[model samples]
Target: MVAMVASSLFASLDKDGDGKVSASELRGCMAAALGEDMSEEEAAAILAAADADGDGLLDRDEFLSLAREAECAADEGGRYECLREAFGMYANAADGEEQCITPASLKEMLSRLLGTSQHLGMEECRAMICRFDLNGDGVLSFDEFRVMMHDGLM
Candidate 1:
């Protein structure tokens, strides 16, 4: 099923009737699919992370990776894994060595989640940290992130 979905998505993204998906095509497809444009940084990061063959374009096998990831995100356990992946991604992206999300990164993450670079204010991010930061360390650990993501689950 995921294979079929990936094939269909690949077909749609392969603009200009090409058999591969370039980074630009992927950026446009992401914007159309999400109803918000992805920043160049985001698109580039995605391409770098997912481009398996080092070809600078996504072929069938490469696109299947995203399809599989999306399939995982659709399930409950996979949702937890997805959250963990997101936390790890940000934690590793940060300059600090604590393996946690800094407040500034958290603010940017919130803004991204809100679908705009400036949709979320620093104050709002601070308030959110106050609400979820159990250790009061001014940064979000994976536990804190899980709590925030699963606020309604409990």
Candidate 2:
């Protein structure tokens, strides 16, 4: 059952029905499927997450590769649940009724969750923030942070 759901989800994510997902297509599909409003920065962060080959696009294989990685990290059910819980936590920590989690907040959350320091001078974190900060705001909302973390873990 989980596999079936996962397969369906992957197919839906493969927008354009071309068996491959371009960056724009993936972003649109994710936004639509997740029922989340995303900023340009958020979309870019998602793209970077799924584009494992650094080709700026995601083919079916790449998508599957990400799924496999996630599956390995946690079974499908566990991963899905973790994501749901994380989303809830983020929503609760949002700045206002808008329920938006900023990039700075995301960093803090990740650092805490990962047992890192408040001041992360790691190159990985720097690169992640740079790659996902679409508006040059130097901050990523919950939506953006989720996408970035999804990609990184995968």
> Which residue runs of candidate 1 sit more than 4 Å off their true CA positions?
69-154
Each candidate's lDDT (Cα)? 0.70, 0.59
For every model in order, what is the number of clashing pairs?
Answer: 0, 3
- The most accurate candidate by lDDT is 1
Q: TM-score of each candidate?
A: 0.46, 0.42
Q: Which residue pairs in candidate 1 collide?
A: none
Clashing pairs in 2: 49-151, 101-142, 103-140
Tens digits of lDDT, candidate 1, 1-154: 6577568668777765578878787787666544578887877777778788888777878888877877665778777788888687555343556677776777655444333423667777677677878999877888888887667232
Q: Model 1, residue 104: displacement in angstroms?
A: 41
RMSD of 1: 10.2
* Candidate 1 CA-lDDT value: 0.70
